[model samples]
Target: MLAQYLLGKFRALVRLLIQCVSPRQVKLETATYLRGSKTSELDDEDHNVVEWAFSGAYDGDKPILIDAENPARSLSKNKSLDLVTRLSGSFEPGSTVCLHLQNNILYPILVLAILATGCKWTGTNPACTRSELEDHLRVSRSKYIITSEDHEDMVFDVLCRMDEDIELILFSDVTVERPPSKDGKHPTLHDLLANSTFLPLESRYQRLSARTAATLMASSGTTGLPKMAIRAHGALVCESRSDELQDAHKPYKIRRLFCTPMFHAYSFPKMVINPLRQGQPTYYMQRFDDTFIQKLSLYSITDIITVPPILSRLVDQARGGDAKPLLQSLRTIICAGAPLTVKLRDEFIQLFSNPPQLIQEWGMTECGCISRAGDLDADMPTTVGRPVAGYLVKISQEERVEIPGGGFASELLVKGPQLMDCYLGDDSATASHVTSDGWYKTGDVGYLDARGRIFLVDRAKDIIKVNGWQVSAAELEKTVLQVPGVMDAAALSMGHSLDEHPYICVVRTDHGVSEKEIREVLRSQLSRYKGSRCELQFVDGLPRAASGKLLRRKLKAQLTHREK
Candidate 1:
């Protein structure tokens, strides 16, 4: 295994050197490209036929969702189609639905069912509070919400506060004795599907156009709350059929386990929807656990969809020599959502005798996937590779720093077909993100190599990453302000990449307020990733400009000085 690993690495290095010596343009072949006006190639009259196509690909006895129950329960593709057909009746055409279920078997079926009926959908983070839930509902203006039985009470409370007649569907099979009869409007997903007959009406999907919003994706913001980016049907379709790998000649069989939250853009559309379209199977977990690492062997996982922190944990386990033997079947590992530190990447390569081919991708919610590492001469681990097809990337130099391999540092700007339609109900915000000529300001600082690969340096946005999840510094400051005696607060990132932690410096109005009390209040209000293990410090005051603008660079410098 060690010899094979060395041989593979040597081959990759040779390929990189050869490509560098004899550089060639990777041309976009128009003949092989699949062009469609909508999610499917079917005309308006045949639009409803798309649902049947999904089932037809895997009609035979093939399982879809597999979880790590004592004895794993799997659902066949045919059985899933039946449930989706019945659930389609509950949703109306041209309406938005909120899908907030944790990583459960019902997620993929519910998503396809919503798309089948031409109703737009958006996902909600399970960590959201009632107030955040209310804000998400208001911003998306959804007509229905589908959540697990665990969140029934919270969903009800938030809906009542909204004062809207939104329908609620609890995605659960566990029967509970209610007060003789509950409200007819709020029904369990089991009851809804069991009560309705499977009506395979073609008209249900016919009215949807390519321009219709298929998803209301959330974009992490540096200030205020997260903005809703409206992803169109055309955008999803393009991403689903993206032929980014030029070396592939035939279909590749993938049995993957996706550990990221389903609400994320990468895990949802790329790992779930795209795999479903290709008739591939993906396993799910409510969250990462000890059992999750064990399933790599149990399920014979060929591919893994993961983020940086999870990889860090895996590295730790492998170093202990407990998890190394179980990872033999892994052929590919794709890392995204956060920076993959060079140290971690090298450690992973050294630990496994026959390591999986590591690939890195760089993208944002606004644009589906801009670059893939496989397409460029990725001799350096920091480089994120060249832009994928149908997208163009350029650098807007804000810094004069130049790197040896990666060129001058600047703000990365992009223009692509998969760019989102707009931010929901916020035209000014939409206009601010996108340029008049169509390029979207990614707010990420990076440099482009001569070969077109992008290498990131820093972020222009004031955000911190906790386990690859974006935590807004502004949002943290706002939450800290809610605590009594917190006159002023500022949050900044400490360390780099996945090692980064949210560090807060607070100015107290009252001397009685202790750090423990303030931290307890924050933990209650914010999610665990944002609050639980955050570093807190009492400061005299946060640096600010005369016009009340936060001088974050100065605060960062102060932190540097303190560490020194």
Candidate 2:
């Protein structure tokens, strides 16, 4: 045992030395599959994720999580662990617990408690409509749901519609006091935590394995209805450590402002798991709004993980007046979920005298972050950088032929420790996406550069053929966004595949730009064949998922209904 322990430490030291001395360089053409520089097999032990999280290098007394709205309410590492132990007895082992609340101080602790009790966890957007909530509940097959008082009616209505006997638990704000529950059917979280017996940490079930499903996050569902993606404990554990190779050499203090929805996979591990493991302090905002700039200045936040739309909003706010003072404390902005446009990236950088580093990440709900552009490669803003440690990426044509570097755009296939175990209860769907050889089809179309950097073009299903040439809807939308007055845009095929033309739905500012001017700009910016047969429609807004992904299918369906 001692020799094995020393060997494991030696291996970790070697990996760190290699990463620090010379980062793994990607030799794109050396093999059919491109692997990251650092690699290791994760231990597939029956370790609970909560235990792994608490075993990090965090101070017991320092505040780890704070409620931005009510600064007084916070949790340190020790306090959080105690809360998790107390709440663990409230859940049944092996049952699924669903959270339907916005970002709050107790969100991460609640997730830990649920996992600690050997319960699988999932979350739905609190703003989801009845139908959407019904779909989520039905798919997750949750036995209990925890929601806030504001959304209790909606949850009850959805439960009634589904006719499922799922127990509902109201989540009370820790900062505010509320009367005890009058109905036995629904008890508030505060009540449960107070009344439930505290189970000794060692007395809890200890049968969890790496393959145990820890979370069931809903996919972005931009193409259709959302599907529950099953993420195993091992995958999430690997994902939480993804940045170690890049960040170990430069350990800096980070005070993060986490406003992104916690329900989405993009924010889940980053906000809940990483902060605890890294000993970083995070302020939780219920939602983002006009006061976002104020909150940044108020909290003196150093870093943020967000999407492109929020950055666009910041750029617009900067244009109104000087924003450097409010944003002066920000050191880094990690953008993911959707592709970041060059125009927006440049504009955002120009906001500060000393611009914070903007790192673009690429991944999906089925997998945690696949790649991230580090500070060293910040100049290449267009690319999503190379695959991070433990991930292998390859580009493949529809016929499963591997494409070499600098080839045309094809579907991106990835094999990684962070890949989802399966889509919950959907073997057919899982089989269709994961190949027999274990590559997970990403459904994204992009090519790797000579340096092994990934440049995403568009979704495979979103590509339209015009005049026998394939065109990317994302590329078209990016071009449209370059127009001065365009605030938002979505590009889609207007007709059948063989005879398709680009149709752009745009939301414009008060600048009053004409469709003719936009067409002229597109003609100058894009290929003649790609731009000539384009149609434009000005709308107030475009449909988008909670993650800021364009709902192209929804937009197409709306247009089809209008044409009918």
Candidate 3:
């Protein structure tokens, strides 16, 4: 009753405020309509943020539930400036906005938007063409773009390709190569920020629709075309509950290191955006380096968002005395992307003062974070953790059985608002992935136990059937990475032979581990049937994206070329 009463008061207050701001009397029903209806047979889970907003739950008057108090040396010299100044200027209501740049800078902007009284911050892919960029701008209905000096030309060029008048916020004054005549157009990012002024925009009871674009991010297009992933505010509200995935929210002022590309799911949701709701400072590496990670304690850093390979580098650092006790300051470390092996996870835990939690989260570009296993118990390194709060996941039976529990690990399907509304410009692809029932079929295979924890076995695409026996490529790579001097490994099957075993390629580190040593290690780990048929090839490093995800298909392409 108390919650209901407070919500009623909140609605009245916002109604009064909106009328006061607009000269003409605002449309009570048209301006903010909070209702519940559906055309689908099964739409019980649909949540509308706009409805919640009108009722006060999502009203703009709510202070950020996520706390931001980093006493530790987390905030960068520039991040402090970004946390306030940037949002105050860019998120003015009634004005359209667009943000383009690299992944490293968008983290802070996402944080600022949550505090911007219901402003929508649309994103564009850095690798997108002028055509795609312009199309997204027109469709999204953005008025301005917050860009950097590096992208000034591209943004202006993209603008020229569009019909709308565009505004910009540039951080640096940069120009291209000098010409003899020196008669080319050039402008600084600072030029716009200084001249642009933003007024106070406080519209109470503001909430985005459940289907409204929460924030825009693009997929890397490993399989096909790059597409925009639409996230609705209600999904964000659900994703915001991801904080509960951590056993207890530690109230600490610690510097968090961000090295992953924030545009994708690997880091943006799990590492950067989620942590900000806690109100801690996150330091950006703009670029990644092992040495930069090695010297983090010098900055009083306690947490880091990284992939396994980077952790492998840190483990290498621990083997030496260079980073030493200073590395001890690292309170917690998180890993995502590829699976972490038992050997690697154990080594990382031992190096920590008291085994920092190794939070392994699982998700994709289309769906934000779905489940997170806070840390791997020594017994269950292969098992990714439980589903985050407000999330439900199930695995389909590989074969049709009389009755199969969706809870069992099969093909992991997620049903949550945190999922993308569609793959930009590709309705067929979107429909193919998302079922009419609101369940998204994740290509990766995993099962949930009674505890609701998600354990991934392998990607369905990478699974190989050997005489009707199931074989996991990831299982092979995990064993290969354990060989003495072997730094990294990846596995893939090339062909279906008489017995159905395909060619497997192994990428190695510069640690001098040889083919013979790797083969011997696999022999010890695998059965004779699996081991005798294996082949090994040594290469420099695995082919991966900027975000550190391996592209086995690319590796196979490289191998095919060599054979040709």
> Which model scores highest in TM-score?
1
Consecutive 10-residue window with the lowest summed lDDT within model 1:
27-36
Candidate closest to the true structure, highest lDDT: 2
Candidate 3 C-alpha lDDT tens digits along 1-564: 354345435544543454356423432111011111121311334444322222222223222221122223234323433433434444455444666756443345433443343555566646555655776676566677767667788788878877787766554411211222223254334343444355432332134345556565555333322346677666655664454235245544456666665555555554444443444445566545665555477566777767666777778877776566667667667676656666776677666543455677666667766666653332345667765555557665553222133323457777765677886566876887788988787877665554445666555555554432234576677667667677777777654422346355655555576777777876665544455666677777789999988887688888889999
**Predictions ranked by TM-score, top down?**
1, 2, 3
* lDDT measured at residue 552 in model 1 versus the true structure, 0 to 100: 90
- Candidate 3 or 1, higher lDDT: 1
Give the per-residue lDDT of model 1 (tens digit) for 170-270: 77642222332255546777676656656773455556655667888877655557789988776765555553232133234678787678778877665
Candidate 1 vs candidate 2, TM-score winner: 1
lDDT of 2 by residue, 1-564 (tens): 354345435544543454454222543432235677565644445555786778787578898888888778888888887778878878788888999989988899889888878899999877555655777788888999999878888788878877787999988764344556676567887788678787776577466766788999876343334568988887888877775445565334678898888977778888788777778778989988868888899988878987776887887887866765788677678888666776777678667655566788888788888988855554455689888878999988564334444346778899987899888888887898899888998888777776668877656666555633445676677778888888998888776423468898999998867899899877766557668898889998888999998878788889889889
Model 1's TM-score against the true structure: 0.86
- Give me the displacement of residue 514 in model 1, in angstroms: 2.2
lDDT of 2: 0.76
TM-scores of the candidates in the order shown = 0.86, 0.75, 0.59
- Model 1 off-target regions past 4 Å? 1-60, 70-72, 173-185, 194-198, 243-252, 375-378, 397-407, 510-512
Name the lDDT of candidate 1: 0.71
- In candidate 3, position 111 carries an lDDT of 36
